[model samples]
Structures are given as structure tokens and as C-alpha cells.
Target: MHAANVPTASPLRTILLCFIVAILEGLDLQAVGVVAPAMAATFQLDSAALGWVFSAGLIGLLPGAVFGGWLADRFGRKKVLIGAVILFGLFSLLTAYSASYEQLLAARLFTGLGMGAALPILIALSSEVASVGLRNMAVSLTYCGVPLGGAIAALIGLFSVSGDWRFVFYVGGVAPLLIAVLLMLWLPDSRAYRDQGLPLRDTSQALMGQGRGFSTLLLWCSCFCTLTILYMLLNWLPTLLIERGVSHLDSSVIQVLFNIGGVLGTLLAGRLMDKGRALMAVVLAYLGMFAALAALGMVEQLQGLYMAGMLAGACAVGGQLILYALAPRIYPAKVRATGVGAAVAVGRLGSMSGPMLAGKLLAAGAGMSGLLLAVSPLVAIAALSAATLLGRDK
Candidate 1:
């Protein structure tokens, strides 16, 4: 039987399965961050070395996302997604067993590769299976798994704080294995895939169609800027607060509030996008992010900072959700996965660079105000791009 001909499951089960896969994928994304301090202490690695290790995983993610998208189009979303989960699970398990920094770094790179592929396929699947009125909501629900996974990692770290970073990986690896098994049993291929008959060659041509053109380059630039700013905050906000005299415990608490805001904003974006105002939502979100960051830099009061953190987190992360909501609409069904995957892949470059840039700025004695100001322009640029692209009907 043709791979695409595999029996499809109910849409409700498919969405649930996709959500589970998202949680599993998110666990892997946050696991490295949760264990980074422990890993550094254990290996006596310098900041530069640790940065390389972190970048390695992000570097792998770029190609992984693109390739995974192609595979989903060529094979089937369910098949590619299952493979991604299994690959990530196995590598995460190996990461726990690494005896040296290099080994752990390599494992993380491979794990990231698996993670890169998993998200686009899941996003495509969720969008495909959702009802017309519920598509954005469903997609947002799946994406919310990312912050949920981070929260889970933080909880695990809190409970297992006896220097056992390995347990963190153990949890990350095992959860995905369980989810993959369930996915194999329940997730179905996207109907868009069946209707489009999207072969591998078609996927490739679609990604390359507007290649080297002004519009394509602009889109890539927009994606890169959006992701860089988003990840930079995700990776460094808590530490930034601590540097500004907030206690570690307070910083962690603030991080929790930030994540909570992200969940609410994501859900709100879904509802707003469904109302046919995705561009407006993105623009408003960017403005909110700018105001929040500015407030964060200027405010010395803890209450003000906490409020700013919540607003910034919600707007910044929610803007990304809007981008994904618009992605499937921007490209044809035949190349939908490839287009989104390619955008995300390019965004990884920004993601990898954000932390490094922040480190360099810090080293150069750029205070919190300067650093925050530097990143604010990115949101403006993204907002303008969204405005310019607003006329294009999805």
C-alpha cells in the first residue's frame, strides 16, 4: 500500500496525538537549557566552549527543519513526525550517558536535528486537521506545549537539584518515546497532503521558486529577525534580571510569570487570527513588546519589572504564533510544510546568534538599557514587514 494510503484516525485523536508530540518535542528544546549550568560545572567548560555547544544544536536545527518539511511532504506528516520523535528520544537518551563535553554536545546537535523536523510537521498537521474556525486555536494549543515543556523542565530541576543533570535527560528522552508510541497508534496524515499529492520534487521546487528574489529574501530576513529576538529573550531574560540585582529565586518566579503570559497570549492570538486580523494582531503585539522592553529597562521597581516581563513575554512569543498562523496561508498546500520549514530553518540562524550577540554586548560593557534598546528594533522591523504583507490574501 502507498504510504499516504495508511488509514487515517479521527481528527480529535489526531490533534491530541499532535499535542502530545509537541510536549515531547518541547521537553527536548528546554532540556539543554535546564542542564547547561550543571553540565558546565561538571566539565569545567569555559563560556566560549559552552556557547559553541549551545550553538551546535541550533545549527543542526536549521537543516533538520527544512529536511523534515520535505520528508513530511514526500512521505507523510504522520510518518515523518513519528520518525522525528523516535530519533529525538534515542539521542536524548544518549545525551544522558555522555562522559565528555564533546559527546554531550554531539548528542544535543543530533537531538536538535530531530526537534527541528518535529515542529513544522506538527504545525502543518494541526493546521490541516483543524476546522476552519479552529485552525489557529489548534495550532496555538500545539505551540503552547513549548512553554509547558520548559515549565516541566524547571519543575524537574527544582525537585532533582542534587547535581543529577542526567535525570533531566532521562525524563526528556523517555517522555518522547512514550509519545511516539502513541502517535504511531493514533496520529493521521494531513488531508492537505492527500489532496495536493505533494511529492518530494514539488516541495523542493516550491521552496526554491522565489529563490534569490527580493520578496523571498525579505521574508527570510523577517523570519530571522523575529526568531532571534524571541530566542534571545527566552534564553537570557531570567539571567538578565538576576544581573540587575533580582534574586535568583525572584528571577525564576518572574520567568514563570513570563511563561504564563506566553500561554495566554498564544491563545489570544489564535482567536484574533481566526477573526481575520492576523496582521493587526502582530503589529499590536510588536508595539506591546517594544513598550514592555522599554519599561523593563527604565523601571527600577520590582513590581514594574514583573509587569513588563509578563507583557513582553506575551507579546514577543505571541507574535511568533501569529507568524506560524500566517505561514500555511502564505504558501501553496503542495509546498506548505517546506515553506514553513524553510522559514523556521532560516530563523534558527537568528536563534543561534541572539545569545552570542547578547554575550558579546555584555562583554563590551553594554548595560541592560543598551542591550534592550538594541533588540527593540527587530520587533519594529517585523511589525513593518507584517504591515507590508497585509494585503496578500491567504
Candidate 2:
């Protein structure tokens, strides 16, 4: 599986390293959401201002993903990933240290730049490292770290002393810096990338060559829609629950349940894909996502809200896993990271817009139910697009 001329590490080690990094990524990505109420209180931020705050980090992700993947293709995934980790770690700490709202936004932007860079490389490395028969499972296992991390962040929020949110950011920042050291010591370069050594392709050729253009568009559409709802909930769920008169502690618990469900859903999505049930995975993920979104708005009881939150997390995360698993297969090895990066960059656009859109909806007098129902149709679009990709992939 590896070239005689290139160094390689065990697939187990590579996947483990990737999983650890993913946990840190997940924690930071979801940290803002869990801490939103406290942070808003600190800065006297209205929902509209908070929306831009959420988007500032997402805006940074775009350039980071585009260029990070391009560099990894040249310098190697390990290096790019390590640098990205360090970059994000430093900036996340800055996020905690910021004395003003403007400083906070700047810190989150730079932190997202680093985080945005790490995700594509993590996906690329996991896909390239595992054997073909186990690729989906490998990627899924690696992705499980993300939700696990989010669960931890929710726990932090739940137990926070004196309503301080910066503490979660501190843990998020420190853990990644520690992990970056471990990655440098143990993580391996992609055996597939090292062995295949295919020539690089132009963006147009890499993503849209031959008759693949339409399918690529479909893939991007599904990814965009999937992330839009996922991040909207991740960033807004707690506030939504609190606004509906749920206690902060209950909101945190619900968020924890959501992440745990995400972990399970990510694993299930991968397993189904590996078993040649990709279509089933698509249907369950998106249709369930649509239903869960509506349920969240309608459910009044705490237990009902818990069920809805868990379902939403599961379906949304599962849908995202489907896209991450599909991206590497659509392009050749050498240009694989770049291709995946482009797809991820588009997804980040959805991620950025989700929070901002929710903010706008709230500003315009939409309740939580109104906001969620409005976005449910996008799940249908995602379902159709992903289903088409499966037929095309075969």
C-alpha cells in the first residue's frame, strides 16, 4: 500500500491521530454555541451582532480551506495539518483573551482559518490511509471525534463556574496545542498520496472534468444545505431553547445529547456506506433531518425537545459524514485534497450563512419554530442532490 521510496505509518496510527485532532476541531467549532448566552451577556450583544460574530470565524475558513488543501498537496498533509493545528490553537487562546467584541471576532476569524485548513487534510489523510474496503469506516471513526469534542464543550458549559464562557475556549485552545505536539511525533503522511503520485490537475479539471461537472454541483449543493442546518443548530440551539424558557442547564444537556447523537450518526452513516447502502444512508439522514428540524420547533415538553435535538444531531452529522466520505473518491490521489477542500469550502459557506440567517430570522420576528421550519425544505434539496450523487457514483 506504500511506495518503497516513501515513508509510511500504520493505518491504525494515522486514523487515531486524525481522530484526536478531529475531537479538538469539534470542540472549538461548537464551543461558541454552548457559550453564546454567556458571551452575549458579557458583551451586551444582540442576536444580530451575535450572528456576525459567529460568521467571522466562518469567513476565515474559506481561504484557509482553499489554500490549506493546495499546500498539503505540495508539502504533505502531516505538515499542513500540524501547522494548521498550531495556528488554530494560538488563535483560540486569543479568543479567550480578547477584551472587546472586535478583538473577539478577530480572534475567532484567525482560529477558524486554522481550523478550516485542518479538516480537509484530516479527511484526505483518513481516506488515503485506509484500504478501499474500509475507507468509509475509517473516515467515520475519525469524524466521531468531532461530536465527542462537542459533547465535552457542552459539559464545560453546563458546569461553568460563575457563567464564564471563556473557560471552554481555554480548554479548546490548550488541548489542540497539546495534540499538535503529539501529531508531529506520531502522525504519518498519506500512503496513497505518497505511492500514487498522480499529476496535479487544474481546479476546473479536478472538480468538473469530463461529465463530472453536474455531479460536482450536486455534491456541493447537498453539502451546502447539510452544513447550513447543522451549524445553525450548533450555534443557535442553546439560545433557542433558553428563549423558549428552558433552563441553561437543560439546554447544555440537550446540546450534549445532540453531540452524542452526532457521534452515533456519523458511525452509522459510515457503516451503511461501507455496506453498499449509501442510498439508504442518504434517505435516513436528510429525511430524518427535515423531520427533526420541524419537531424541534414544535415540541414543547423537555423530553420531546430532547428527542428532537438528538434526532437533529444524528441526521445532520450523518449527512455531513456522507459528503466527507464521498469527496475523496471523486478525484485522483494527487489532487484529492484540493478537490475535497473546494467541496468543504462550499460547505463552510453554508456554515457561515446558517448562523447569520438565523440571526436575521430572529431579528425579523421569527420564533424558533419559524426559523427551523423555514430551513427544513433545504434538507429536501440536500436529500435529492445526495441521492443523485449515489447513482452517479456507481
Candidate 3:
């Protein structure tokens, strides 16, 4: 019998490429937030129009994720990733030259489709390339590019010359365009997927087969709950702190601390996953999140608040990365991207809803304590979901 050829490329090399792609995705997505004021002024847009412009991009992401995953499975991950990078890059460049609000909105929507498509493929690729035991760590490490990209956007927004919102778009567009060329030359398709030659399956079957249907549901639920809490903290925690008498500067600083904690938590969780304790680790992580949220509700001092914010971020963001890490293991490589994509699509819904839900609760006269208390139990539910997966193994 002839021996089959195997790809000898280092998985770390692939992970590095995936990281760069993720960072570009982060920068492009975050650029809109920083430039919204300028976009509103240039297009003579009202708050309502601006809100729709923001929403147009997010709306695109839902379908893009689902479609992108399907494409990645059908065509191959590297091809889909390269195409997505170029798609977003071109539209982002178009965004830099948009002459009207409607034009910008359309461009942003297209750009978001590309951006959203790239994320799951990147996660899938990272998971595939990783050595067996280190897949969780590898995915967690590469996913850090997102926050790192956001931090870069904040820096550009702070330092860029006034009335130059377009500069960030230019950077966002150009960098990814260049990176796409590199991906074309250097990125490789998954060896397992390449060897299998599996035909495309129905999306439902891809996600809910081989005794994984219920586990998929549990993962979806965990993703929704954790993402809801994460986005709530991202959008509302500072506002809540400010309302509770924290200064604006301190509120912002706490947000930074929160991200720092998230990075730390990802690192810690990855190691835990390698130890064959992913389920227990994630459960405890969410339990810790509940405690952190409780502390945020009770703490009044600046020092105490700072500690609580970091811990909250550690649990929320770290837990999210853990979910990403777990997703690839639930399916064969042929359908891995689709599976992750569907989960992410669900999570994005929670992302959109979280801030709105928090706002409504606040408007309805929920105190910070009341809000935090309400959120705390949801993490427990998420933990219990992870436990369900654990039970199946036994």
C-alpha cells in the first residue's frame, strides 16, 4: 500500500496567520465605533440613521456567518478565508470613499459580511492546526487578536488628526488587502478535511448528528448566555459605574482593566483545557463570574470596583474563548466551520440584545445591584449546560 502524504507545516505558523486575520477583523469592526461621529457629520445623519448604519453591519454578520461557514466547508477553509478577507477589504476601502449615508450603510453591510465570515473560519482553522491536546490553548491565544485589534483602534482614534475618520478605514482596508495576498500564498487547508472528501451535508445534520444534537443545543445556550453577559459589561458597565458615582476617567480605566483580565483568563483557561478538565474549568469560571458580578454590585470603593471589573471580564471574556475552543471538538473537520459558525450566529444575537435588555432594565428602575443580581444566575445556567456535556461523557 502507498503511504498518504501529510502536511508537515507547523500548526503555530497557521495560528499566527489566523491571528493576523482576526486582528484585522477586530480593527475594521472597531473602526466604525470610533468614526461614527465623523460619519454622522459628513452624511448629515440623525441618530436614528446612525443607529441603522450600525445595525446594517451587524445584520449582515448573522447571514454572513451562516453562509461563510457553509462556504468554508464546501470549498475549503483557506479559500473561504482568503475570499472573505478580500471581500471585506474591498468594501472597507469603498467605505473610506463613501459620499452619502446610504452609500456608507451599504458598504458597511457588505464589509460586515466579509468580516463575520472570516471569524468562524479563523477559529476553525486554528483549532484544526493545533496539536491534539493544545487545541484549546491555540484557539484561545489566537482569539486574543480581537481585543488587541480593538486596543489598536482606540489608539488610532486617540492619536489621529481631527476630521480624519477616513484614515482608520484606509488602514483597515489596506492592511487586510495586503494580508489576503499573504493568506493566498501561505495558508493551507485542513489535512483531515482535505483527505476526507466528504460531500456537503444539510446544515442541521452538520450541527445535530452523531449523538451531538443535544450537546449542540447546550453549547448554543451557553454561548448565548455568556455572550449576553459579556456584551452587557462591554457596553454598560462603565455607564453603570458612572451612575454609581465613579468618575469618567476611572470608568474608562476600569474597562481597560477588564480587557486585561480577559486576556489573562484566556491564557489560564487554555491551560486548563489541556489538562482534560475543560468542562470543570468552564463551570468554575462561570461560577467565579457570578461571584465577580456580585462583588461589583456590593463594592463602592474605587479599588474594590477595579478588582471586580477585572474579575468580571476574566470570567465573561475567558468563558467566551473557552466556548470557541470547545466548538471544533463537537464535529468532524468536514463540518467544523459550519458548526462553529452557527453557534457564533446565535451568540451574535445575544450580543445585539444584551445592551438593549440592560438599558430597558435600567429604565424600568433596576438598580445596579438588581441588574447584577439578575445576571449572576444566568452564568450558573451556563455552567449547568457545560455539566450536561460532561454527563454525556460519563
Report the number of the highest-lDDT candidate. 2
Total residue pair clashes for candidate 2 = 0
Each prediction's TM-score versus the true structure: 0.93, 0.93, 0.91
283 in model 2: Cα distance from truth in Å? 1.0
Q: Which ten residues in a row have the lowest lDDT in candidate 2?
A: 1-10
Q: State the displacement of the C-alpha of residue 279, model 1, in Å, after optimal TM-score superposition.
A: 3.0
Separate clash counts for every candidate: 0, 0, 0
Candidate 1 TM-score over all chains jointly: 0.93
Candidate 3, position 162, lDDT? 53
1 or 3, which is superior by lDDT? 3
The residue pairs in collision within model 2 are none
After superposition, candidate 1 runs with Cα above 4 Å error: 1-5, 158-163, 198-204, 208-218
Candidate 2 on 66-120: residue-level lDDT in tens? 8898888877888899999999999999998989999999999999999899989
> What lDDT does candidate 2 reach at residue 364?
94
lDDT of 3 at 156: 64
lDDT of 3 by residue, 1-394 (tens): 0115433467888999999988888778667766777888988888779878877777778888888988998888888999999999999999999988788989999998998899899899999888888988999888877766765775565555456789888888999999998887777777766865864667687678778899899989988888889878876787789899998668767767776777788878888988888876787688879888988888878999989988987888788888888888888877889999998888888877777788788888998989988777678888888668656644
RMSD of each: 2.3, 2.4, 2.7
What is the TM-score (0 to 1) of candidate 3? 0.91
The segments of candidate 3 whose C-alpha lies over 4 angstroms from its true place after superposition are 1-8, 158-163
